[model samples]
Target: MNQPEILQLFRVEEKRSKSSLRQLFAVVWAQLKMMLAYKSWLVMDLLSTLASVVMYYFVGLQVDPHQLSRSGWGTSYLAFSLVGVATSNYLWACLTRLSHSIQHEIRGGTLETIAVTPINMLMFFIGLTARGYLVSLIYLVGVFTVGVYGLGAKLSFTPQSLFVFIILFVLMLVSNQALGLVAAGIIMVYKRGDPLVFILAAVNEFLAGVLYPLELLKRFPALQVLSMLFPYTYALDGMRRVLILGASVFDVNVLTDILVLGVFSMLLVPLGLKMLGWGYDRIRREGTTSSY
Candidate 1:
């Protein structure tokens, strides 16, 4: 190719890469700024974490912490519950934003502005999501650190377990996005989404073997299979196995978890984008795009 043509192509590629990076960071930074603006809300959020920890401690006193220890689950209930908290937060961040975010922006007149932007719509949505997702992750880290140091609980910071944990963490994010995409679709079409947001959140927290063992779901085969498909199930279990149980990366069902999460991500992205596009088209055709 000619020098001018080659230079033009390079410029185009470079711009695309820059735009992608910018979108990613922009979404995360915007959420952080918004969170910062509400100092009281942040305080409340932190306090809520503390409150949960206290409640857990009180209940731990009532029950035997060694119960899980005997089951070969983990060393302590605190270790078990902290991992649950982290995974649950990640799922909540992804699903909550997916279902309500666009509707929220649309009602606030922000959607109109976002729709007019020159960037790719999917990229923009992802950027917007990255904002809250990162904040939630930061909150999770704070909770974990406090649980480890403040409580003086045993936590593994081993390189091998850390590697496995990172892999599961990413898988968890992707699976969370799948649920988010479905919620976004419902919001776009129905104006009000299905009441599954709260239900899903509850399940992620209570059922997905987050605070307890998957064996608890054994009697309910359907529930077991359903929870098995959930990324939170693998994530909470994997975290406990690695960080508390001192298990190796090769010791857990890492492969199966990754496969399920990968499949969910592959399906959700295109579905979400299509849903958003369809919602936009429906609004345009019906001339209801502007009406909140």
Candidate 2:
């Protein structure tokens, strides 16, 4: 290509990049403003977190710590349950945020605008969720603090444990984000709520050991097999090992969880994008983009 042509192309690319950035910032700012406007939720968020910690702490006092230790879930029942509750809550927020965002946009009659806008849809979703997840993250930190300090729950904060926790947490988010994409696509086409969100929540709560030991599921052979179908099972197990046992991601037991999440992300993410595009195009083709 000629030097002038290359320079013109570079200028066009620069403008496009700037425009995309502007679009992203606008979405993030709008969400932030809404959060600031409805400030009552901020107070409720921390208050509810504290309540959960206190409730669980008392409940933990009634449980036999040795039964928990036998399952390798640590002797402190409070920490075990807090990690599960916090992980499940944060993950649920991440997993449903996208579909909820879509439903809100549809109600506001902005789905059509999003469909036609010349913006990066991926970045659009990222911008859509960034602010909300930031708040959820802050809530998670509070839950951990109250559980560890206020309620006397035990947690190991070694570098190895932190590394595994970070890996599991990120993988957990990535894998769940795909489910959110699929759920959002379903909402877009059906003009209804995402059943997948609730279905997964129910499954995770019962089978992922969010508040119980996975070893206890052995009594129900069929349910034990069913639990293996969900990635949260591994993620939660890995998290418990990291937080309670201070295990590294590279450790044999934890490595299995890492691999499971890695595979889930590799498969689900691409499939989710394709599914969302198909669903969105189908809705737009039917002239129902804003018909929530």
Candidate 2 lDDT tens digits, 70-121: 9887788898998888888767776678788878888899877976867777
Q: What is the C-alpha lDDT of each candidate?
A: 0.72, 0.82
Off by over 4 Å in 2: 1-22
All candidates: TM-score: 0.84, 0.90
Show the colliding residue pairs in model 2. Answer: none
* RMSD each, Å: 7.2, 6.4
Residue pairs in candidate 1 whose N, alpha carbon or C atoms collide under 3 angstroms: 27-131, 28-131
Worst 10 residues of 1 by lDDT: 13-22
lDDT of 1: 0.72
lDDT of 1 by residue, 1-292 (tens): 9999988986783434447667767766776788789989878887887777666655555657566676676557776777777667778878877557777777887777766656666766776676567667777877787778777667787898789888878877876776777677667767766467767777766768766767767799988878866667766777777788777766746566666667877877678667767777776677654465
